[model samples]
Target: MAKSAKTKTEVVAETPVPKKTRKKTEPVEDLTIAEAPIQLQAVENYSRFSEFDIYLFKSGKHFKLYEKLGSHVAEYKGVIGTYFAVWAPNAHYVSVIGNFNGWERGSHPLSSRWDGSGIWEGFVPNIGRGEVYKYFIKSMNNGLELEKSDPFALWCEVAPQTASVVWDTWYEWQDEGWMRNRRKHNSLTSPISVYEVHLASWMRDPDNPERFLNYREIADSLVPYVKEMGFTHVELMPIMEAPYPPSWGYQITGYFSCASRMGNPQDLMYLIERLHLEDIGVYMDWVPSHFPGDAHGLYNFDGTHLYEHADPRKGYHPDWKSYIFNYGRNEVRSFLVSNAVFWMDRYHTDGLRVDAVASMLYLDYSRKHGEWIPNEFGGRENLEAISLMKEMNEAVFKDFPDAQTIAEESTAFPGVSRPTYLGGLGFGMKWMMGWMNDTLKYFEKDPMFRRWHQDQITFSLVYAFSENFMLPLSHDEVVYGKGSLIGKMPGDEWQRFANLRLLFTYMYTHPGTKLLFMGGEFAQAREWNFQQSLDWHLLNQAPHKGIQECVKALNSALRNQPALHDYNFSPEGFEWIDSQDRDNCIVAYSRKGLNPSDTIVVVLNMTPVPQQGYRIGVPSVGIWEEVFNSDNPSFYGSGVSNTQVIETQPEKWHNQPQSVVLTLPPLAGIILKKSAK
Candidate 1:
């Protein structure tokens, strides 16, 4: 009875043997379908996909296609083997080609389903997981033949080798406590300070810089470091398989495959599990906007623009030199949405930060006049893409209610973060690109001229509450000739470090969740390089070390202080105490929690000149103490600070009931909390 083949429940409920501990899996020895004891079956009686599955896939509602469309190891009758299925509607003939058959085409072919769903599926006996394979497809339209990787593969060969590996998403997860209570951690009002990391370059082996750290190795170091840094979450730059390293994982070739450069599917799961065990959430960047035109990728599958649009004006991305998905197509939408859900379901990712959302929403993104086509409504909006996003977000929230879907949208599209029922796009949060741009531009200018640019810094507050926002100082700011965050500061070394510290202080106290790129926390002095590790040696220097300490303190405050997070998405959480002090290059604001007693005041001195006895408004009549100061000597700032608690007098200032006189340090930020009597 073929050793009493394992049931589907048994296969998935238990962990797959790890690569290191399992017996070596090699190409089938001198085996071909014609010479084997068992033959391929046109699986109908033992088919994994049913009629309803095909209907759902054709109608673009099959969000769980991974369970049916991919190569799954199973037993047919009493023989153990693997079942393979793929979607190539334009293909006249399709066959499985791999090392098992000496890479010979037509040795074993798949059968097209009778349902007219354009799906090809079959079960080949005597073969199981760990087999490397690709599909040999002959186009029905042009007779064009090509080999393509599986779109629903769970794992692919490490980049530089374009072949899919038969694998399973089985792992013994130990994050029950985290899974049960992640709703509060991922809530809109919770503290969500994300540390964006590019896995390849974040750290590399010291002895062999060329070798990438496997997922388990990364978990050993990343979990402890993030826990110590006090970041609530770690946002990984896309870990999906992409051939070109320079694309930084945005150019995905395998939608459902884990980047084999790191490790197998289980290895990546272990990394996420480690983070969740430490109470830290994981957010993966998902790219549905476009894909690279690699030979084996989704560009021209089945010798037709089946995955992308037929028209170059609608299909191609000029800026990125890639192909945009045909979001209007039902099957293509099913594929994209299924990929999004696959990660969250199989990998236990806490959220998906959808990338290049602005490009997806606009038909004329980066195109000149006469180079683009308008939507049916004669507008620039890509209605099809918008609908796909709404559907994707709805499916994600429906299945995983505690999970979040963030958007990296740059344009001022109305309600990018609002719910779909309210005529919005239905994302959990949108990147505050305007705030990131204006804040950087204002900080780049000399503090002497910041008075004239006061409006630039405060303008974000005007539309702050329009959507649930996440203030991002992301990887985009430190790459492609844009200098490092600290390098953008305009001053001597001492003043530059102070400005960086001040930037973090103001960002934490701002009215939004925060996201900072990897190296920015310690003030790396150079632009980001994907090929190498961060400048970790900079920590030995006092100024760089101080910047790290300041960021750690800021993250601690963001996580522990309810006033900083409770109303981050609402106007009730933030109130301007004194924004009209631009002459002194000063601004003060109050952040409040649900309870009025948890109010905290923030003040910033943009210039490198101290002001003693600077009066600021207070919301309560009590002694207010300095809770945090960026000017502390430990952060490499001038030691000017308010050393004692100051009693608020019964004076009306800045529309507040009480006021207090305080010392303002040069080029620094300070937080004041009223003490309980």
Candidate 2:
């Protein structure tokens, strides 16, 4: 025993190894609970430690470490104050670099401390209000250099590089009281009748396509026209800052800043204010799905992957080739949430039509098989992105209770417009993409083919209850490879005009909110091109002007008739009376609820052959008076129908007495009024 320690060292050095004494080292057995207590305890400890490690891993402790490092930066909060924060987990030193700081990186160096988990923070006072800034960070790990802009920047204004300005300044809203009053009487009706337009292309000078007018100019030129056309809302394409000239503002570079190329931010505010003054609501096209591909822009603005996640699996939108924001990240969530608040609060926009919702809803959205990973539970992983959208809608509704948020979702996702707390996306309305596609296809068919297509128009009523819908002839449907709405008609010019008029009438009367494209009222002959001006000169022609006048009258009638405005919000408002006629093509429907005593029946004939004594089934037989005829000569069509006088009829069928037997002309529609008096 006394010689054991010294002998072990000496024995190892001097003694020869004995084959019998050299017992083979046994392989360690995997410890089980029933095994020896010491070994099992060690295994138990390891199992517990492993679980804790996994909890931290899935809970994003590593990501939080990055966040903690950046929280110590100077923060400004106010109506116009800039809030600055940075994320430099491994940075030994960080400084503010921006125009406000004279583009200097060293003067106001950020102080950072490792919180044991690799996070550093320091605050910079008075650095945010309209002051453009970036971070100059020095990495302690390898001296990696990085200069990053404020990820939560309300305004990032960099000329020809990043266009983000500090817009922390507040504006005095003179119309707050008016807005409150308007909210009291607002109704959620279908057949939304939206007129989508790009302010830049809507009315640029033909002589100079680039010489666009200011907000005031456009307001002055377009307000009267939109108001007269009876559109309930105007859906302007994205007015946010974008890089590409012909992107139609889809490739948004600035999330908060209005398109400076269009005009100053104040100009857009004035445009909305003026539209509100005209009693016409404005819905902005908001692209929250992805960012532009430009490097100087939102994509990786920090020189490292800050706004976007590091993994291409999570950060890249393959379809758009754009940078996808990490919705699962808090700072990124704050950035987008604040951006949404910025629009509604600053611009006073009545609503937002959220673009490309379907693209945002799926993790494997627009991806081929085997390109994406399923969630941990193995179902399609839309949880994180869907949760972000739900939060967005909730915040928007909570802040601006009266404002609407509409979704452009092509997929039949359930509860898209339901309250977020109800396990659904909280949207005020959803674009009836199905109704638009089905209705357009139905209208484009020949009368001989229409019978097969009539259900497309009528059957939409089945799912109408899912969400409040807007029947939009959106910019997407009228541009690029898609022909003009009028061009989609399967007939000659006159028949085309007739088809269009009938379509508009149906759109206005259908069971959803309605949206028409710019120049759709006058049947803009050309497809919408963002690079070119709308054919405003077409208005100078008689046929076009007549169509414009008809639109105006339709708007007036829509406003005047309580039947149109009252039940417009309800699915029960629209009831199809005839959906099964192929020969002599007649479809009639009645809009109920606005005025119970006074009902409006609309009958359409797309056939070229006129029918004599055409008996259309009336909901009740009363002296049905012809209220509106699309073929009235006053509207630039053959006056083959009666005038706009109220008709009285008694119930005839099913205990109804008053049914009118009249000749139906080809390519004509008649709106009849039933007077209970």
Candidate 3:
């Protein structure tokens, strides 16, 4: 077994581990699969859990703890009620308070099991779904009374209203074909062009202005658009229920519930089903880093920092004004790991992009030198969170091999996307923040000054394959004063549009998967506003419309061209033809598939000056066709293009025996494939 993150000194439980602690996890063998997740519908006396169940939970290896702990509706003795269980170790007393009992605590007092598991449970007969409820707890530590929302809530009330609704997983899914063949779409070599979106702001009723579309509506609108643009996946920003809107769903309150602002859990399921049917995979942006310290949320339970740390330095997140989970605790790991699998098993989600992973990996993230604590090894790494991430990934992958877990980590943490058994974090992919930063820095510079800093663009290939990287120009780059991507270009109107086209061209041809935030495909001039809809009217203009058309073409080519997507993670797929040509600010490269005949040469001119008869090398001395041109009139460029074919010369150049003279358009990228004989 791997080392647990709980330090030898800190004991989260009220009592220390017993003699069975040193023994292997043999207690869990006592419980059978029959005891797991069967909903009841009668007056149930299922008030106590077996010691074996609690033992497995205490070991932090029980992946299905959600079914045993949270509210589960069932029929027992012909009485239908919801079974409620909670972990509040420090509380002297706990009760379920809700509208069913007129918010009275005495109506549904819970009993503490005698097993020392620190769990309380009770069943209420004749009460079922849609009832608002909260846990009223009297703290043994301070006598402070607290009423908190359910941590495992399935459906929460809309923002500004705090209540947990009893929801049933009752969606009839029609995505069996998608679920069966998902491996073909989620493979490392598959073309994964993700369109990132925030549901609330993605669109609103044009006439009403303040009304956001629900899940079903988005399926009708967002689904077709993604399919038409040829994107293979759609990565949604967090849809978890939150009290604050500007937090953009990051300040999570209900870790288990989908945001009710969009509709019920079933409606969200419908949206996912539609997407899967269309062959578009769905990835949820899952936040397991920190949660806001809202009064009704997970800040304090049992009034003793049950979910977080008592120490401010360890528990508090200064950047987001939230509280970090005490990952060293066994139950906390079970909660997080169970939540990850819940989405994959219950909703058929293709992947989870773990958000704010850098903050979770390091102990001193965003803190002053003296304000943070080190791990047991006296290092900055937070071993507990590392263990939790590994378990989450391991659990998700073990059951659903077609699913994936991606990391949004920014630091140089080694082996972030590697398998866990190899002494690494078990993640499927990681965002390429360095590439996004370097590429944007190069593009934002003036064309005249860009040649002086040509290394900025070429430096990314140095460690591009360090992980299974996904090149993301995500929502983070478009909001909070960073400005829209097109707005950051250092040029006039026409030049900026041209630069934007060139940037997308380079992004698609780069050696990684792709993700673009909403509105970027159409060149929305305004920055993203969570409160408002995307500026969809921009499509009426020629420049913005042209950018949209170019993106469509790029996505189509990225999916169909095996040479581009076949060897995405291997460095052998890419070879530079002429990267040292800083004088004219032009970079040329070739991409290869498994077969030598599958080859495409890409050339880019960063400046506004066109170059005619610029010689570029090729592997074979044959005709090269201009397959794609960013300078085409469809993209609103200068229209300097090669409409005809050119034969390669026998003269040697750029480490290749055959070369071809080409017309390189200004501020453009062109793709030329070997002619089909």
lDDT of 1 by residue, 58-167 (tens): 89999999888879877778787888898888887777877677666656677766667777776777776678888888787898878899988988887677888887
TM-score of each: 0.94, 0.81, 0.93
lDDT of each: 0.89, 0.65, 0.86
Model 1 spans with C-alpha error above 4 angstroms: 1-44
What is the C-alpha local distance difference test score of candidate 1? 0.89
Clashes of 3: 10
Candidate 2 residue lDDT tens string, 1-677: 12332343243234232111112221111123112111111121111123343344234432222212222222223222222334444555566656555555555554332223222233444543344555666555565555544443444442354524444324445666548755643447433456788888888865677787767788888888787676767888888777676778888866666766665555677778777877777789888788865754656553456567677766788977887777787656655666676677767887888889897787778877876667667766567778878877877887788788889998988888788878779888888888888888888888677766667767777887678777778777887678888888878888888788777777766666667778788888888887778887887876777677777767766765666656654756767676677555677777776557656777788776666666665666445677677776767777777533323345363222445666666677777777555
Q: Which ten-residue region of model 2 has the weakest summed lDDT?
A: 38-47
Which 10 consecutive positions of candidate 3 have the poorest summed lDDT? 20-29
Superposition TM-score, candidate 2 onto the true structure: 0.81
In candidate 1, how many Å is residue 435 off?
0.1
Give the higher-lDDT candidate: 2 or 3. Answer: 3
The alpha-carbon lDDT assigned to residue 401 of candidate 1 equals 93
Using lDDT, rank the candidates from best to worst.
1, 3, 2
